[model samples]
Target chain A: MIIRKIRGLFNHSVALVASLIMFIPVYLVVVNSLKTKVEASSMGAGLPTTLNWQNFAVVIERGKLLTAFGNSVLYAVGATLIGTTLAALAAYVLSRNRSRFNRFIYFFIIMGIAMPTNFVTLMKVMQLTHLINTQIGIILLYSATSIPFSVFLIYAFVGTLPRELDEAAIIDGCSPIRLFFSVIYPLLTPVLITAGVLNLLGIWNEFLLPLYYLNRSAYWPMTLAVYNFFGQFESDWSLVSADILLTILPVIIVYLFAQRFILSGMTAGSVKG
Target chain B: MKARTYPFYFAGGALALYLIFFVIPSIMGIFYAFTDWNSYSTEVNFIGLNNFRTIFSSGAGQNYLHFIRNTIIFTITTIFLKTAIALGLALLLTGGIKRLSYFHRVVMYLPAVLPILVVSLVFKSILNPATGLLNTFLRNIGLDFLAQRWLVDIHLALPSVIAVDTWRGVGYIMVILIAGLMAIPDEYYEAASIDGASGLDSFWHITIPLLMPVLTVTTVLNLLYGLKVFDIVFVLTNGGPGRATDTVYTAIFDEFSKGRYGMATTLSTLLFFIMIILGYFVIRLMHRETEG
Candidate 1:
């Protein structure tokens, strides 16, 4: 009994230690971001002697975080709404129809899960369309790239609903569009939130696409802003840390409030698909 | 409002966006791969297999073979470490530690939620050779011999990149495994205990077999992501210390930057084919499992 008690305690401590190890990087960023320039250069993980909120102000000014933050919100929201709406509409069709054509299209979208976006060629295509280095371009690109997964996710969820709902709505003198908007779409809230949150997180955090497309600082997203900021402020650890914190702040907040939905939604897609 | 016709209308918007941006670009990518395309060239000429030959041959300091080797090393090592550690952590979290498990899960998962760029930048500073926190912590604890130039040393750079990738990734995998572990019924363990089976015995006999499906999913997910990994390598090393950490994706990016558009497309085309083969197997496996 004593040995068992000791073993349990040992395991718990081991977990605690492991958790602390996993957290040290975050802890370093958070703590150092609040320190003065001198204190930050010391590179110690200790708390600041005084709470210096000036770091945030400096990063906000230098990094142009406000503009970048706005761009991120616009891109993420625009892309998510467009992708999700299109995907939901398509998913409704794919789920309801059992035709060979519909099946083939559904399978084709599923193949995109394995397909990595070829940004090398994508850049050339973007140039040809004159969409390179533009917010509209990034939004359109994100929406397009995100369609496959969004369609697949919504298709999976839509499959779970009974065909009776569609039948009942159709018999009640409803057009297909009206039937979708009034009855079927309401039933898809859970999966919509799932797909929306997942895509929002993905588009918001995406670095490569925006990095390649948006060369202008004015149109840079949050991730790109942080990257460019780091290049200019590499010597100033405190400022860079502040920039990092600010960049992730919105995402962290969203994740905190929607933790349950995001976690379950992420795993649900993987498991079910 | 014919039901059948409505379906076509519904799919039109998504199909338009997908075809123009995704499908067409993919096709264009391959076609361009066979031509001497570059930013400087007004009209691309057919180059046949020359771009591929450049990669295959030892000319122009291409280091193509090295990139492939490094990619395999990075993908395999990181996947192995990430899966093993995630499984270990999942087992521990599920091993009757009830009250604080939620807190632990949230804390561990916190990193995975942060942007990969942020994670890479944070680690870039943290692993700095001079006055970085990691080395400072090591020295403070009298482990001075263990410290080395982490991201810059040719010998240490690739492994350092892999370690950072595993650090950021293992938490997400652990959450997946935990979800898998939780799905497992407790009755099996209870019965095993009643029959005088040890903890290890029950874990091996019951848990391993039952968890195979989830494990396969996790493994394939890791492998797929690993094969196409770019963000972390780009942000951390930029495939640097003289291309020591270069993967195929980074190689493509570099060639594109240097106006070697045809070469870049060749690399991209090869990667696409590899992905298609992998996708074929994944679809087959999933279909088999679902059917059975």
Candidate 2:
């Protein structure tokens, strides 16, 4: 009994240490963000003597975080809605019908989970489509990029739903569109939320897409804004930390609120149960 | 009846966008890889195998092969490190610890939710050689000799990037492994114990076999993410310390920024084919898992 108690204590300590290591960087950022510029220079783990709340205001002004925050919201929310809705629609039809062509299409789309974007030629396509450096373009690109995984997740979920619902709706003279939106879509809420949260967080944290495509600072998202801010104020650790804090604040909030969905979505296909 | 209720056109919107934005660019990239496409040149001249030659052959001041090597090394190392550590953590949380295991799991997985760029940036400060938290702590604890230039030395830069990546990623892999571990029926362990099986025996005989599929999924997921690793390297070192840690994706970005579009496309096409092959198996595995 004593040995078991000791083992339990050891395990708890080990878990605590691991969690601390994982959190140290965040702790450093939070503490340093509130420090004065001199204190923040090293970005140490020390508590600030006086919290500099003005750092946020300075970062918001100098980094143009307000515009970036708005852009991020627009892109994440817009892309999530479009991507999740379209993926749900597509997954429903493909999973239900399961025609050979549909199967092929489903495979082709999910194969993109491994497909790396040829950003060089994507530039050409973007320019050709007049989407390069445009807000709508970024949203569309994010939505398109999100489709594969979204469809994959929702397709598995679609399989779990009873086919009786679809049959009943069809027999009641329900049009296909009406049947999907009015009946099947409501049932898809859980998976839809899972895919939406994942996509929203993914889009919010995405930096490379905007860095490659969005030239104008006005269209830049929080990731790009924070990166650019870091580059400009590499010396001003306080302000840079503040900017990063603000940039990731929304993501952290969403992750905490929707962690169940995020974790389930992540492990959906990887683990059976 | 199926066709009437579930129309094919419903998939059109997603298909169109994906094809245009995702698929077409990749196809066009293959063609452009054969051309001398650049920002400076308006005319894209066909130059077969030249970009490929440039990548394969060692050139003065430009080592495309080195970048490829770095990418492969990064992928392999991160896979090993992440899997080993994650498995350990998963086991510990599942069997070793009982109290607050869920809370610990949530805390550990927090890093995965944070943006990689932010994580890297934060590490930039923590790993700072002179005044950073790590070096200071090492010095304070009388471990001054261990305090090395984390991201500055060419020899250590790649490892540093890999370490940061492992830190950011291990939690995610652990969460998946935990799910995999939990999926195993308790009866297996009970049966093993009844048969006088040791813990190690049960782990090897029962847990390993049952967890193979999930392990494969996690390995492939890590492989895909590692091969395309960019934001971490880009933000942390920018493939710096004299190009010590440049991966294929970072090198592609470099080539694109330098107006060498053909070379960039060539590199991307190379990764595309490799990933597509691996992705085929991954999709097959995932599809089977979902169905089963």
Candidate 3:
């Protein structure tokens, strides 16, 4: 009995240690983000003797911080607004009606998850649309990219919805758009919020796409701005850390505020369940 | 459901965008995969598998193979470690472990919620070969010999990426599995305990079997994620230390940045094909499990 208890205790400790392991690096981020440059270097994950807000100001002011924030907000919101509706419309059609396009779209949306960002195609698309350095360009790209999930999530959720509501509306001589706008749109608010939030997190924290496509200095998003600001000086660790922290804070806030919804929605949206 | 043409119009607004945007480009990508189309060129030619040929023929060929190999390596390692660890935690979390259960879930998922860029930069400092916290901890524990170059050396770079990745990601896999466990009933456990089954025996008999659905889903998700990973690699090594860390996507990024559009598309095509096959098999496995 003693031996069993000891072994159980040992296993329990190991599990707790494993859980702790997940936090150490994050602690590293929070800790190092607060330190002065020299202190950050020599005393990694150490605190700064005094607080410094200059790094954040540098990122926000000269680093075009407000513009980046505005771009992130605009692009994410724009993409979500237009993209989700477009996807939901397709999903409604696919879910409620039987047609050749339904299967085509079902297959198309599935294929989207499999499609990695084709850099070559992305470059061509950008040049073709003059999206090279514009917020509209990025918004369009993000919107197009988001259709797969948006369509799929709405498709699955819309499948569970009763058709009597739509049929009753049709009996009342409602147009298709009116039937959808008045009936389906409000019902899909749960998934709309979920998909919108998901797309927002992805676009808000996006880095590489903006790095490649959004090359104009004025149109830099939050992610590109943070990365660019970080590289300006190898020795400016405090500024770098501060910018890094700033880029992260908005995302963290979003996650915390909507944790339950985000958690369930992500699982519902991603899992085959 | 009533027979209605209205659904078509509802779907029409969406189908136009999907067709014009996603469908056209996807097919175009496959077509461009076979061309000699450079981004800087005014004219292009049908290469007829020449790009694929070039990818295999060039010195960069071996690097592509190495990336495929390393990706498989990283995916398998992390999946194994993550699945085992996540299931273990899921079991414990379902055990009603007092106040720490909620705290553990919150603390554990904190890293997963952060962007890969944030996680990568923080670890860059924490694992610095010269003056990082990890090595400092190792030294203080009187294990100086245990330290090596974390992200700078080829041998350690991939391992470092996996460790940092596992740190940020295990919680995500864990939470999903926890949800899986919670969905499993308490009666099964009570019934097994009444049958004189030990905890390990019951977990093996009940928990593992019940969690297989979650397992298959998470594994496939993890594999898809691992195969296309660009941000972490881009930030951590930039496929550095003699290209020891290059994944297929990173190689494509490099080619794109270097103005080799056709070649990047070729790599993307190969990646898509490989994933389609793997994802199909995983789906098939899950389908079979569900049917049974």
- Residues B24-62 of candidate 2 have per-residue lDDT tens digits of 999999899899999997999999999889889988469
What DockQ would candidate 3 receive versus the native complex?
0.47
Considering summed lDDT, which 10 consecutive residues are worst modelled in model 3 chain B?
B283-292
lDDT accuracy of residue A221 in candidate 1: 91
Misplaced by over 4 Å in model 1 are B1-6, B286-292
- The order by descending DockQ is 2, 1, 3
Ranking by lDDT: 2, 1, 3
Top candidate, metric DockQ: 2
User: Candidate 3, TM-score vs. the true structure?
Assistant: 0.91
lDDT of 1 at B239: 98
lDDT string, candidate 1, B1-292, tens digits: 4455355789888888888787777788889889998889798999898888887886767889788788889989988999899999999999857669878888888888889999998888888999878898899899999888999999999999999999998988988888888888889999999999998998899988988887887877887888899999999999999989999999988988998888888888888888878877776665454334
Interface RMSD of each candidate, angstroms, one decimal:
2.2, 0.8, 3.2
lDDT of 2 by residue, A183-248 (tens): 999999999999999899889999999999999999999999999998899999999989989988
Clashes of 2: 0
lDDT of 3 by residue, B62-133 (tens): 556677787788888888887887777777776735446766776677777777887887777778888878
Q: Which ten residues in a row have the lowest lDDT in candidate 2 chain B?
A: B52-61
